[model samples]
Target: MHYESPVREPLVIGDKTYHDITRDVARPIETTAPKMWWIAFSIAMAMFLWGVGGILWTIANGIGSWGLNKTVGWAWDITNFVWWVGIGHAGTLISAVLLLFRQKWRMSINRSAEAMTIFSVIQAALFPVIHMGRVWLAYFVLPIPNQFGSLWVNFNSPLLWDVFALSTYLSVSTVFWYVGLIPDFAMIRDRAVNPIQKHIYKILSFGWGGKVKHWQRFEEVSLVLAGLATPLVLSVHTIVSMDFATSVIPGWHTTIFPPYFVAGAIFSGFAMVQTLLIITRKLFNLEDYITIQHIEMMNIIIMLTGSIVGVAYITELFIAWYSGVEYEQYAFLNRATGPYWWAYWSMMTCNVFSPQFMWSKKLRTNLIFTFIISIVVNIGMWFERFVIIVTSLHRDYLPSSWSMFSPTAVDIAFFLGSIGFFFVLFLLYARTFPVIAQAELKTILKSSGEKHKKHHSDDNHGHH
Candidate 1:
């Protein structure tokens, strides 16, 4: 018997054209029936509200509301700061590194990921700003030559470097993301159902008519932006790592941190991508575009980067022992056997052991399993940062300095609130813009048709 084709609807090949494909997918990652728009709008608004509420509470109270003490000064705040920053790295990586390598997959996800990078960085920025007991004087972190006092923002401070590095990264990444949106925004502007959306898109598009010269110039600027962003991604994480690595803190000091942190940034960043996209594709009804193949590909990256992170963990443990530095060795030992040993082990289990399961082909293809693993990876990475920061600092050299840290109610609430913030922003994004990159999707469709034609022609040649 002839094998039945798996194909259902035979999409009108080339009839849609590259421009048509880009126009449709540019609205949302998935298409909603006219009836579904209300549901999408309501959900997005609710999440945004919760996020706002959480931030307000943080401002009204103080950092004292967190799980911090004099002995254990860092806790969830710093862990989350690093985690969000790491998540931001994936944005630039997808847009920048992939462009340099000429990878097309970057096209499909880069817009959303870049937006994710900007929003996550915003969330990450909130921590350092509000973590200051005097949130009113956040300007103190900025290095403006002030005549107000002798207090110059110390050039020698890594915190100051972080201020410069993060500001530059945020500004550049935001511009890059917005610039890429121009053509797509033009599509939305033309197809817009109402005057409001049309006006918004018109302004955003800045008057593009999809001219060839426009695409040409757009591509050139995108390339330059990608080049700038590649270093920006590497530098931001390295600088964040240096905030600790440059320190006298035993577990925090090591040359391994820069690259190690970059790898971890990519790992956690991908996990957040998977988490958001998995839900996004479903909600928007764009299964054909996102595809099971896409998730599998991401799973492979998650496993690879996660393994790199695991190796970093093992290397740190080995180096701690080999270096024969009592402080470093003791820090590692304390992580494994001390008061927060559970946190340490939980991190290893989630980040190291859980993602290793993706090595099995069967599991990688299982969406439910991959989703669970994504959550596990996120949790593991968060705890990894927490354990690194808290365990080493809680017990300094002297016993008199040793103390345990636990997050208070406010800390727990604020952490939970930021998740709401991220999702809220993402939910709004899903509604306002296309969840899937339409322009990028057109490239894949072109590639797919070419593959099918090639195979069909080969079959005829073999028969001849």
Candidate 2:
């Protein structure tokens, strides 16, 4: 009797086999970095350095350097923080939620998505630190014994909850991402030509060998981590929303913020993923692995989440009018027709209206349209945060304190710099890391490719 490996369609395109999957993923890391990667990296580094200068200038000149006033204490800084946090949520969704659902398509994109999550969160973490005016004494927010006195941090504060939630999320996501990379790192280590490359990957892989027991443990550990990460996805954003929902401000105090924010997070997260992957697939020549089918499915998610977010916007308006509270009613009214109405409309147009384009199959699958809308979605999400934070606070109870908030050059610099910082990390990651999960892709190749189907058909005909 002869033993035969199961024959099926390839998951990887370009007629790739399992060995090819390993070779393709490990190629960037094993070989010299691409010229395009370096060009993008240089641009990103310049932006990052520009942002660093802005941070240093702000610290030296004090918070007064930014356009923040007493009436609008929280402006671009908090808005960017929320935006980055929301962007990070999709990564957790792709890694944890999709994993639990046993969605095989996620395997191609989840590795990079998880990396995006970690890097975006790092960018988000910078905001609260910089916004603190006295960032040097930032440890005071932690529940530690202080030298000044036993002044305990406020346990009841949502801001403190943010501290806990963001920290836990970053830590778990790092562990989750590193764990997923171990097998791929081992693949790279095995094929490495340079002694330094081999040693680095070996250390990173934790000596992973292709033993049956090792495979079993890897799957078990992945499942356990996914289980742990699932609830954090919901909780992290909910806690962030509580920073507003728990407030007494008319627009901020709402019962619907948790689910609304989570939907928006996934919406924005998927858009960012699409934006990154579309560029990635084209740049690295991995169309077979990251297919149009994957892009279409993600667009569908964007449309669904965008609709949910739109409905949430309407629900907030209805609830405000129904409550008959002058403050709440005026808050919603101000958002639509007041001084900052432009921001509100921008959110509506980009988020609610733009995603509707995806309902058309041709548009959803069109790479250019998907990329454009992905960017639009992020822009809209940023406006959503701005409208929520600044618009709500700009005109409060006392009309005497009414004032318009605008971002300074420093504010704009910091935000743009954060973008540079995020891409800088991501570009480096793309060059050095396995962007696709080789081990996971191998498992699905039989079911994914056209060649496998042809092989199966041939085998069945021969048996007949």
Candidate 3:
């Protein structure tokens, strides 16, 4: 007599097998491009071109081409810079922090999340260079010794720390992303029928072969990198927050900034992940692999981080009022009722109020509502940065210097263009690579599918 294995809920549905995982994940890469892919790619390219035009015009005419003025020198450019950087944080959290915690569900999404991290950081890095006005001499921020007086970067300055932090984050993320792709690249190399495709994948795979030793080394290396990246996921944003916190500006100076910024980063980053994955799962017919369960789990994270961000908002208000510092008090009061009141309220509504919907299971699980709220969360996060930067800078202690900032056509173009750039990279990645981790998914097959359990039972009975 044979005993049955206990039934479990499937993470990868549609009764998928290990072979099915490989075929489904690799199909997008090996097959011809779909019409929708081309249409999307075309739109992204157009936006990228517009961004290029904006950058070139700025370089030619100087920073004056932007809406920046004396009262608000750091306007749209820095706001966009911080927004992109924050958006990258969710990828690191999903990949590194989740991995450390032994979360198996992350295997399906970590590949694309890491890719998003690298691309978003690239977009974030652009703003600082272009904002320099004299783009060629931007390297002056580095600590390299120079002929003129052996000038060195300021160690105590947060701005200098940003240069180092960003560079380090980009380098580590790129290496981590590429290392994870090697196994999948080898799988693709084995599957390729065309000589050119086979050769390309061979180089990309770095001669990876599925030996026991190779698998052992892969696991060890992944664990080590994940450990390293976990701290960075926290530190990078903390340093970014320091850019504001260290400043004497009333609205910007606060003790709650480090944790607050980190929470907001994860909030925005998860929203972006949802926005991309919802479209991807639909377009690629990957409903079985990237299931509703995955979507719901991500929404839960967004809700958690969104709540933390909301608390940070209220804390800032309370701290300002409690301190009785007139400057700090006015900063909070002005944020809610000043000329930029609309932006502030928009941030409050989207970040604080919208996420409250997730308390209902029905709303969290509903795809359309989740998608819409995810977008709203990102918009709110962006406005949160804008409000922090602009409102803090626009008004001075000497009321005579108080002024408002309005974005120019170039500023608008660059911001919209950056969105296009991000999407363009993502679309290309979806078509050219395994968006899901096929090998990792195979490892969990026995635990996730009825077919795997039945197969295991048959093998056990035969041995008996």
Highest lDDT model number: 2
Candidate 3: residue pairs that collide: none
Clashes of 2: 4
lDDT per residue as tens, model 1, 263-367: 999999988888877877676555555666667778898999999999999999999999999999999999999988999999999988888888998999888
Query: Among all windows of ten consecutive residues in candidate 1, which has the lowest summed lDDT?
Result: 2-11
- Superposed by TM-score, candidate 1 places the C-alpha of residue 409 at a distance from the truth, in angstroms, of 1.2
**Candidate 2 clashing pairs, residues 3+ apart or interchain:** 8-452, 9-452, 10-449, 11-445
lDDT of 2: 0.91
TM-score of 3: 0.96
lDDT of candidate 1? 0.80
Q: Residue 186 in model 1: shift from native, Å?
A: 0.4
Q: Model 3 Cα displacement at 343 (Å)?
A: 0.4
**Given candidate 3, what's the lDDT at residue 2?**
26
